[model samples]
Target chain A: MNTVWKENALQVIQDIFRNQFFDDSLAITEHTTPADIEEWDSLAHVNLLASIENAFNIRFTADDMANIDSIAVLLATMVERGAC
Target chain B: MAEPTHMLMMAKEHCKAGEHARALEVLRSLASRHDPLPMQAQYARLALTIAQGLEGLPVLRVAFLAGSTLDHLVGALRFWLLLEGFRLEPYLAPFDTWRQEAADPSSGLYSFRPDLVWFFLTARDLKLEALWGDQPQQWQEAAAGRAAEVATLARQVLATLPATVLVNNAEASATRVLGNFEGSVSWSAASLQRRYNLELAQALPAGASVFDLEHLASCFGLERWEDHRLWCHSKHPFSLEAHAPVAFAGAKLIAAAKGKARKCLVLDLDNTLWGGVVGDDGVDGIRVGPDAGAAGEAYAAFQAFAKSLSLRGIALAVCSKNDPDLAREPFRSRQGMALTLDDFAVFRANWDNKADNLRQIARELNLGLEALVFVDDNPAERALVRAELPQVAVPELSADPADYMRVLAEGAWFETLTFVEEDRSRSRAYRDNAARNACLAQSSDLDGYLRSLEMRACWGDADQARLSRLAQLVNKTNQFHLTTTRYSEPELTALSLADDAWVGWFSLSDRFGDHGVIAAVVLRFRGQAALVDTWTMSCRVFSRGMEDFIFLKIWEVAKGRGCTRLEGAFRPTPKNGVVATLYDRLGGSSVQQDCGQESRWHFDLVAPPPDLTHYIADANGSGN
Candidate 1:
């Protein structure tokens, strides 16, 4: 994988997490839960899915956006979708 | 802990957490709290009213405000009512008796509170007619009289209050609303500033700036509100991301009210402005008669609506893919045609691709492509224009001509500020541009073209006569622009007066005709670096290299002032791809590369590009 793509992927992950969580200092981990950040409410979960899709220039199915709950699950979904 | 304050905090938390339904539930519970203190009751009522309004629950909003609560609730109700499309008169009716009682000073209402009296009187006066029924003429007259009396009382209260007191009152009472700022920062900022100016003039006292809730909202990517908890929690009431219709409507209103309304409505004729293709239908076969038939009536109605837009001062132009003579015959000969050839400012009826035809129309009208809203019923045509001329607002229209009028009316296309004098003169200005083009086409050499047409370029500050044109160009010009910067009218005014900014516009005319203010250049001086923030030339003079001439003049001014570097930026937009290579061709080196950094271009005055003979030198030895 290209180093730039790896960096961009991490940055995209960070942006999605920060915006969804409203914690600028948020460090995206594989185990982060929706409840851990006060700002990661139901609406932010959907927004995070959409942002990730846009950053990766891919489409997320309704099921995909709805099913993902944790950062680990989201990352797995992205990997399954070949987004990273 | 007080139940109402506790509920308020919970609701605030839910609202911040993007759980609008949960927030609304908490607010409802707070409002239903039994027999609370007067202050608590008032706060609860206000909170419920705002929350219900945000939730799009008009019934709940009305119930909370109409209750026998404190008088401040009346003011909150009035604002919410306005937001929900109810006129001011209906919302202020219940406050009349309180105002009269307060006037006596010893009355029970006066003993309760002096501020409440003012609020009651102001609300009543502001909305008198709606309180009193419209049926009885005598009652209506009485309501009007009371309204005037209440207005006087409100003025007295305002006059009695200190400046600081009024400011504090305004700050506390100001409603927090959301809007879309989707375009350039200059355009958005100028529009907000204009609204700030107007709000200050109408509601706020002098020196008060309308706080930009939109800009504040944008700090959290509020433009994409599913990302902003403030918006997602408000039930998508204020964010462009969640509610594009509402956000676009808010932005359009702000833009229109500031007299920054777009200049031209570039329309596609066949199946768009009219029912059938003129080439096939011939003038008579076109569905444009006042007959009772559905299709015929629809076409006639659409034409009438298009014509009515002219009365509102929106210039209509045509770009049709048909023979010019055949396409134009309907306007002149059709029995029920409402929009005539004279109604259009520019008409490009040729078998050329619509995108090209639209480009010609923009050039002939001396208006910016961004100022145009192209309406074509054909999806393919709309898509082609969308791909080719992305700057043009080509709204999708139904193929069934019957739906055209309603679509135009309901869609925020024709919404604008007050129609000014220049609007009526727009059609004639395009006619002049056509003549100028014809003269230019006749000449072979550049100098011969300039001399034969007797073209004179007037450059200076925009006066009252030309300010509107200058504003339109600033807001709309995209292609051939050094930087496609959009500005509202008030921002243009500010730029004209700013010491560091040199704003100049040119009106070019030859013996054939007058091209009304077809070019504008805005230069900002920051210490030693001079920046060409906005440099746009009308598309009509694109091949003429009028921009090179303008840049030469700008360079002279910059050189004379001892400026070190002449910096200009070409922001690569989907529509401005034509200008992507402009800086490179003009001898400016790129200093950065990124999504947004594609716009930055810099030129040092120490090195000048090779001179070209394209520009004709005016008698003063300066290229005009």
Candidate 2:
């Protein structure tokens, strides 16, 4: 566990989310809605999901991601997955 | 706010460059920024908290419980807290109780409808932890029983919560926990991970994959203290550092790992073997003494290492830029050199571009370029080799003589996972290949040369026995690959098990030598077309037209299966340009084109080309 791990994970997730959602300002937060982040396409979603999984060492089922539409949901999912 | 944003960008840049301390400074700067708008201020505060969290600083999360308007901030804080590995028990308790009371239809606060109360509680707990260190052991003990009670209640409330809300809570919590455990662990980190894994598993519906702290730990090699040093200073728990070891260990672990070169080192002599030119020094004049004054010590160490690799099943070969007679003399002379001519399987010491020499060496040794690691001290020589033959791994050696052996030994790129029985005889096999090549070069007719050796091909579905060799070819054979698709064992398993797909591999041998599994073809049946997903041949058998024979075999299989045409895609890559015209040369017509289009070749099975006679059909349909 180093200082960089969390930051790196956060940055990578952010970059992926931003790139996929086409919105750089979208903060990865509990309340951030997927609808607000335009880059949340199906492919981007899967890529972000996989990237986050790889980054944090957590896995998400399709159903788990299906309902996760906001930054809050993502954060909660990370918690539920024991990655947080 | 803009300052914070700029600081954040700078910090991110520094982190990418492997400067963690510098990144922390920027984050600290951002944390000091002030904003007028509550939302902006709260965003900055959350960022500061996350930065602190990354640094392993436990600060209690600040809460805005004044009104419903603060709900968003509360939720955001909760998300950050969970990512930082803080427990959410204290935060969820009040929300669960309120939900239970509100459901009775008799509560006055029912109209209050705390949409973000749970999120607020989560944020407050984090703020508490941040401002005050870890919660007191007594507080934790007292809260543990109550926490469980709250969790039970929360579950009941959670059932009625919007899916988005539930998912958001879950995601935020998981991220915080994962972030904390990813690179930093004390007693709290491990316990948090364990507890969270169970909690998340329980909270998540069935079939949801949980990315737990343990999984993150292993994926990033976080369990090992030494490995943690790679990413301990970064913001994210996972990065290139986490994956580096796995990449290093990838050559070894087969079940979850992928492509690796075989355990045979085809070495170059002359400048490669010793510091001074070997031809100029002669056997006796060459420096091999332990004296600090002598340059030959490095050569001696290099030989010792090479011998060690040989003992470990790595076959050694000599491809030098020197007189064959002069090079052979030092190895055999009584002056007691560490390496002898017999130490190498194939010794090709001639005045030829090393690339061509390497090609000859591969052919003579019956090995693929992918399996060979060419080490030469000269930059020009290394570059020439790299440009002409990209498949062969030509690692650049240091000009400093002292680092020669150390570089070879420590570099994980050449590491091997498993040593098989045939590895010991690799040198001898190459020696036979050299003899075979010599015989073929002397013969005018190709068929006569192939027949003289009495070649045989063995075809079969790859099994555990041949997995290593198959992987080696896949990793190293770059020139003739159709798609050049690389696969780990798991990926290969998926491909093989996928509907309408099959992997066919072939190994060739002759009285000359056994050319271990050197060809792999991935065939996919898609509707009317039998797509050759991946097709590659070892460079050793290039001019012999083994590809033609292989193509003919594939055609026969496709024709029998009632396929109209066999389609092959030639995706151009940096290395495979040598065979860019393969489809046109192989009698395949182009059907379509797109921007950055990989050349698509379609061969109607009704009129397959006449089989070339250069190779005699062996038991496995491979040409001799």
Candidate 3:
């Protein structure tokens, strides 16, 4: 269940970031963080989370919103919550 | 305060001359902190006039409260509304304030009192979290619970606020938990969104409308619609590219809401109405109906749609550049043709320029050119009409023959907020007027013609049944209206019951047919004088001595009330100048040559009314 959810969540996140950066070659992985992307600021982070919530038809709680700082943490949260 | 009327026209001229910056400066000088005009239509037209060639229009007071960041969407909506002759001053509520603004009358939404209030909330704002890890049954329950909250808010707004509330349906994100198989499950996002929309629609009261944002996003494609970058930065769900289409839908709805809907459709023939030009292809050779290929079928479908418009009360007319007989032969002879000669109120198939022809049609129908929507398949003809007669709405048609019907129908120019029984019979009335014109043309002596046609003016008090029609006349009649003061139906009803006021409408019918209520008069008794508050007559009855008949009726009513004098005024508008000499012709002694914008006249009721004895016989049913 974790593997399928993680894979789907990772794909949705990567699609959003790629469009954001306007670079089809931009890549994402478990370790990717805001420091890895120059355009990833606090404003961009909220927009990213909102887009993911809409695309995946799920929501992030206050705890999940604060704790998810990287791609791996975000996907893990979705997988553990069964939201992907 | 609003700018003077002359200044507004000067700014419009500057815009027409392509001095957009100058026009903007002119408009800015007239800007007020409050709503500029007392009348909604006047404000809309003024905004449209000043906004020409400008990047953004004068923002009307519109409170936009939605779940998503809608800066770009509002920009697009504002521009689109301006194009459709509206400029909304958008008051964007803070995020998550939709409920608070709607439920509380003391909120900024009510304080601002926007002409239009738009609410756009996404699934996340409602039940996204509740649906997570939920089964089909659980999903249904969550959707129902959330939708009820939205409905309750809508009801509260409808009760508390006087603005038109526009609520957008929720759009499901492209990410599907169940993928393609989600359709089979009730727990799916699509299912939740659909149910939410249905419930929301049922909850909306009158004065509230639904905007299908989901369908609009689909038209723009879901992939392009959801911009994660913009959404992350600003919470804007829609991309910049999607703004035009989104704005267009909202603008069209607003135009209809304000009763600025186009009234008449002036069509062209040959390549426009059929697959081929009738003059060149001959009557038998022209393609129409389903049997003729795809193009012919499209033309036939178009005719059927035009026929439907006629039935719905939209006046149909023809202004084609063709021989008269050839222009009308297709409608008369073609078995597949959906429309007939009688469908059109005016048929002008001559070598005259289309602009002149359109003017003639407007005159014959007693309609303003601003009320006309000209449709032609020919680009050159369309361009000519657009340039020469700028007031007439000339929509550009697609070059493809098969696209003609869809292009014109999708415009939805003939929009209406309310439908009346009289709308269905509007074309028949115009047809009757055409018959009257035919009789007038054949007669040599004008009096003999009027006498031969058995005419009767039925005078009666305007009751509740005729209030809507009377108000429409008051609002729309321009050419023959003296003191053109538009009134609402409720206002007219109040006047009818007022002790000092009297309101009456007259229906004119001749040997040809009934012209419906062709004249209306409003009088206010002050001391020994009856002030003619309003005297509006349909231009169709011009030169038919209907004015004389109405003058006589007004005299009788004034005398009955023991008033010694009947006072009248003629206020000049661009179209109403035709009635400038009306009071003079009625034999009223000039009281004031200029009372600001209007000229005043009065008649002594003790002295007899101008030689209307000839009309007395007709009023008593002797002429017939």
Candidate 4:
């Protein structure tokens, strides 16, 4: 993974969690799953993804969205798509 | 036991810990105990997290009756309302239930008894195929048919409920049936939708509001807003991206419904209103008004925007740490300046602290600090007001002067659902109030000042034309309201029309200018006695003997209506302490005294008080 892209994406994701979930202590890792955060429900997942797209100024295809559920896959997809 | 303030602090900690439900519970408990810092924006921020799950915080019941799917909208709206320090309980009608729910009073939708109803109809419901078909003769028929249907629905809703109804305009479909020829077709989908929205707006009664969703959709870009996958999956119309903006817009309308709209826009002069400081640059060097430069034009545009806001009834005030004469120079001498000295209700241009100046402005205008929006380019000054007066909204102005207007408008501090004539003429009225103050300062004593002003008060029954303003006074007047009961226009109108109700409005004018509808009195008759349900007056008219005059008028009205006795109550709220001794001043005797909540007072109307009527001219234009 590109460390710069991963770091940038993680910072943006952290802000989204802080704002949307009131999770100021939320620290995203490569292995973090939806189960790790109670507020990472379906509605919030969509909101988080949309916010990420806005932050990066990139559009994700349906296939990319369907596969990018986990942080590891999200980072890989961002790298593949050159979003950061 | 933790103090209420400590509980509020703990609630903040709970919110930060992602225990939003607990945070909300704590906040609610604090609210129940006492008013929990009502104007604190931080509390509003905390509400966003758990509002979707939590219920019962003085809900403004809203019924969503729609033609298309609206499940995606309800949660979004609830979240935004909560974020704006409001609780909303949504009653969602089944899909395609707009016509049925609007037409029938006994429909399941009426069970919620919504304070506001939103009609979310789409282009699909109009069956655009019939309008855009090859049959050219059928275009007029199709258009009329759609218009009639929407008009019928509007009428049914108006007749059925006293709720403020918002009808969403149909957005044009991105799909092109006629391809390149779509622009030429008179009854194309876009044209039909636009026409329908226009007709619907005209057809809706005065109480019903049109949401203008078509314009909003266009602004968001039609293609990006309508998610095909979501539509296919769950009949969701708006994209996930559009949720916040749409919800915020709806919440603005809802906030206005509850009279939570901010009133005044207090401005800072140095580097905020003008590009350069008046003290440092001098009047000629400052970048304001015409032909100064790009920066000057931007400042000029900002002034024009502020002027427009004043015209919309938002009072303007200036709080600057400069010489009063120096501050007056730009408005006095500068060419192409949109704002004038008369535009502002109060101007504090001394070296006093900005927050203290803001408080002075609030006191002079008889407005709450919560109603004030402080706009200062200086981050330090904004921080000062935010710290000292937490109730005042200090919006962070952009570094770029050009973006000031956009930032202020987007802040949505003064978002109101209805803009009556009273709002449009509010600035002029306040300017007139300044004249009255000047006259008062010049006079020898209280009676001398009152008699010198040549004040004329036009008293009448509160009718349709004045109903909205009466309700607005009831909602916003805190310090001077005797029994702070907020009512909507419909409820106020119903009260005005009731046989057992006496609704009186007082419009006072002097040698200076007209203070339109300065006071409102609502009385409910109980056999031979009358109960003062609502007695509210503007703070601007305070100590002007307007209160005494209105009290006498209320007594006369009750007597004329064959009521033998009159009663009034003072309800204790965080803000209404000023009116606690109001009944005592009116020569009223204590009747039903509640230790904490309310104190009721009774007055026998058989004999009136000695004439304090030297100030106001009679209703028939007869001078005192």
Q: Which model scores highest in DockQ? A: 4
DockQ for all models? 0.02, 0.03, 0.03, 0.10
For model 3, the superposed segments whose C-alpha errors exceed 4 Å read: A1-84, B1-18, B21-78, B81-242, B249-260, B490-503, B519-531, B555-567, B589-596, B601-624
Better of 1 and 4 by DockQ: 4
What DockQ number belongs to candidate 1? 0.02
Which portions of model 1 show Cα errors greater than 4 Å?
A: A1-84, B1-248, B251-298, B308-325, B342-403, B414-424, B430-451, B462-472, B484-495, B526-529, B559-569, B577-624
- What docking class should model 4 receive? incorrect
Pairwise TM-score winner, candidates 2 and 4: 4
Candidate 2 DockQ score?
Answer: 0.03
Best lDDT goes to which candidate? 4
Candidate 4: which pairs clash? none
- Tens digits of per-residue lDDT for model 4 on A1-84? 768867877888776666566556788888888988886765566556766776677766666766777898987787677785
Candidate 1 lDDT for residue B432: 58
* Window of ten residues with lowest summed lDDT in model 1 chain B: B163-172
Indicate the residue-level lDDT of B559 in model 4.
88
Error of 3 at B454 (Å): 2.2
Give the per-residue lDDT digits (tens) of candidate 4, residues B501-601: 98889988778777788898999999999999999998767877788778877887888889989988899877788889988877889988878878989
B462-559, model 1: which lDDT tens digit per residue? 56556657766665556666566766454566678888888887655556555556788889898888898988776655655556667777787677
The clash count of every prediction, one per candidate, is 1, 74, 6, 0
For residue B240, model 3's alpha carbon misses the true position, in angstroms, by 4.8
State the DockQ, from 0 to 1, for candidate 4: 0.10
TM-score of each: 0.48, 0.48, 0.66, 0.83
- lDDT on C-alpha atoms for all candidate structures: 0.55, 0.54, 0.74, 0.77
